[model samples]
Target: MGAITIQELTKSYGETNVLKGIDLAIDDGEFLILVGPSGCGKSTLMNCIAGLEDITSGELFIGDDNVTSVNPKDRDIAMVFQSYALYPTMTVERNIRFGLEMRKYPKDEIESTVKDVAKLLQIEHLLDRKPSQLSGGQRQRVAMGRALARSPRVFLFDEPLSNLDAKLRVEMRTEIKKLHKRLGTTIVYVTHDQVEAMTLADRIAVMKDGIVQQFGTPYEIYNDPANRFVADFMGSPAMNFVECIVFEGNLIVESGNQRHEVVIPNTQAVIDSGLETVILGLRPEMITEPKPHAESGYITQMQLGVQVTEPTGPDTLAFGEWNGQEIQARLSPEVGAQAEIDGEVQIQVDTGKAVLFHPQTGARI
Candidate 1:
């Protein structure tokens, strides 16, 4: 079993703490992505898991064996770095074989292993080429091949696609997912890109300032965020948190001197929070182009003055104001066909799917 368990893991440097008591688990063959901004301790946690950094305190287990104190090479893990850390002068075949050769495997065995790994990574044609001669994607594949040849207990990827061009990064993301499916390898990938975390992770651990904000499946992290930070961090267009106040179990949303009271879903959390002022969180897609039969949702229309409309291929993003705070909504190009700066536009709202957060505490209610 390649399952991993982390218990109260904490790492510090000098007087500066990096990881603040992290607890996590990864089932065998599960793809767990560690995502957060730079200096959020994601890379530090990864180093701890790979036995490259000494933990300040806590336990880490790999398949029932505690490996927190194990040496890096003996921890049975391989890491693919963002820089595609291949030997510059060494041929791809030699780079892939270097580790096995260092372990004193026989020449014939090394040759066989290299051939199989090259075939697996589809780098057979480039095996004789130096790292400088290969493209970014090829170098990354070769780096992956080197790790794959070892057949380690776990694979740690430290933003392995960050260096590639946009097109290559997308291609590599899909390729990496395919590799995971084919090999069924337990992997812990680190990335700052939310898109990568959303698209690639079986489970995501979102961190900030050495603390794990939330940990769950992509859908849960996106839809059922624990707090405002997580909700704002996960989405593409980002969620709009409009200022609102509660009055008699209904939300009072004011726009352009006009007021609208939308019914909120009654739940225990709302009753428990007991806060009158709230921030209504809604996604751009929820505020869409009005349809003839937009009667399905808690639809409310307001004469919002449009500032600018941006067409983003699939959907157009229109900028406006809610309660005098800048807000954005998604609209169809045809529906926004006549939208202009400072023009009044009727925008629909989906209050049913809206989330409420305590304005003071920023916690979801």
Candidate 2:
């Protein structure tokens, strides 16, 4: 019953359009993450869902109710923002029960709800403490508790972990995932952190310039991107887009004056494609140190003078040049790509997962 349906939703402010033709359906108990840069209208879309902003056009339905024009208080939703907006003067107990009290719930019922939520969040020990006395993480829990007391149909979180330190952010992210599993409420979370979107979402909607670029599971978006921008934006080190010529059914990438032929899964697509040139998308993990006894079937090598090598404990990152553009290779420490190493490392590029895009349109080939 908590499902939300948005159809051709558009929001504009005078001459500027913030959300352009957004169409999305959030299923009950599904964890959905909306991610993009600062001005991509993710937050604006969240506000529209919560009934805080008036929609300029289109339809919105929560469950079976047409709540597009409903007031914020009437919509069955609870929101937690990036800023933990708890009352400074109220104790944790009061803050948790305030929403229930506003809705005229009985005193005994409110107390029971507070006890249950406090146990769920494991903040029972901190109930006597005021906002000023608690740590940032504790305050955030209290804010979430305040929302949970409402037991609404849908939950909205607008970058709730962006304010915490790195370690606390990781901890809270796990907590939120656990909370969602326990509650099984529909959630629409907005974040600029790609890591968060990948780890916590059942599905991710990547946005750009007020448009949703792609909507799919994290694995699909990462491995099988729809276009160049999605491939470039979703990865940590970022997928390297190397310009190369498509000649004779083989894509070419050159390093140190030697041209390397990269194998494509759809070789016929490249052969039939009228494009003489295209950009090859390769992740750092795909390009690695050549295996000592590695068979040479589908893998190819690129010879490059090593520029710099960095050890990040688990793996070594080697930076080098390909066709005058800087590219990174994730190398095994066993491959002797240590820091200050001077020799050229023969890095193997796996073409199984490699993707090709048109140079001009940035569309997948």
Candidate 3:
């Protein structure tokens, strides 16, 4: 029962407010991830949750207890920081057993716990090595083992894998996910890496400027972002935004001397907004090389003049100008190669999957 509830939480440094009235409820045994760019107050929020920083105002509940004023050690939570923070002179076994030893656990119990955690993290063979003798990934695993030795009510990880290389980061991510499944403890993880948040989180809280932009599952955040900011933030290549005008019930996209009308069915919100111009958001994958099945009513096909093509093994990315704005499309590597040599390609845009945003407010229409 490690459920956490935060209500109207605020944190400030003198006149500067780092967290502004944050409210969130994380269920018991759930993996909740707080993700945002640097300086978005995610780390501050994590600190507040861990009792390291005092909240300016608001109530915080861990499980059934109000732990707003509780000391970090008394909060029954273990934290794994970005830095391994292991003792340079101490062996891995001692580093892991240090927490249990401080609590006065029996020597046999500490040794058994260290062995079990080491096996779980696959670092059992490295137990006799010091921090200086281990690789970055190995050190990170040792840090995790140190935290895992304690059966705490909650686990806090603050960019724990940021120090590792890309390949090692991915491997460690899988290990973390497996650990979460094996031990169904509540976790509040903070990371600036979107891939980590997307892959590991049960739910992600996207933040910006000390405010939560949206809170939902990875699919919801990626497929149905609340606004342009969220839509632009989640994707790899980032979503493309094009400004266009609304006429009748269709959006008019003007490219050079050619004009194309994209009719958006069931667009009551856009019609009621009474705005002539709006922004259209589309993912690169949604625009692709034309196929026989691309002639649907909701699909719009256009010939694009190829400017550049980049082959990235799985798929090729084609870039060109649309309405004087740089637009990108994900195409089959074979088709993209042929299009690059031919100087033009036919691509289909799935307007049914397109999103509209209010240009002034950046909110979804």
Best by the lDDT measure: 3
Model with the higher lDDT, candidate 2 or 3: 3
lDDT of 3 by residue, 133-223 (tens): 9998889889988998998999999888877788878877888898889999999998878788899999989999889999899889998
Error of 3 at 245 (Å): 0.7
Question: In model 1, what is the error at residue 249, expressed in angstroms?
Answer: 1.4
Give the Å error, residue 302, model 2. 2.5
RMSD for each of the candidates? 2.3, 2.2, 1.8
Report lDDT (CA) for all predictions: 0.85, 0.86, 0.88
Of candidates 2 and 1, the better by TM-score: 2
- lDDT tens readout by residue for model 1, 197-272: 9999999988989999999999999888989988888888889989877776777887766999876666455656
TM-score of each: 0.92, 0.92, 0.94
lDDT of 2 by residue, 292-357 (tens): 776756698767667788778788888888887778888777564543366578778887888999
Best by TM-score: 3
Q: At residue 98, what lDDT does model 1 achieve?
A: 93
Off by over 4 Å in 1: 103-125, 132-138
- Candidate 1 global CA lDDT score: 0.85
Poorly placed runs, candidate 2 (over 4 Å)? 106-109, 119-126, 132-138, 292-296, 334-339
Q: By descending lDDT, how would the candidates be arranged?
A: 3, 2, 1
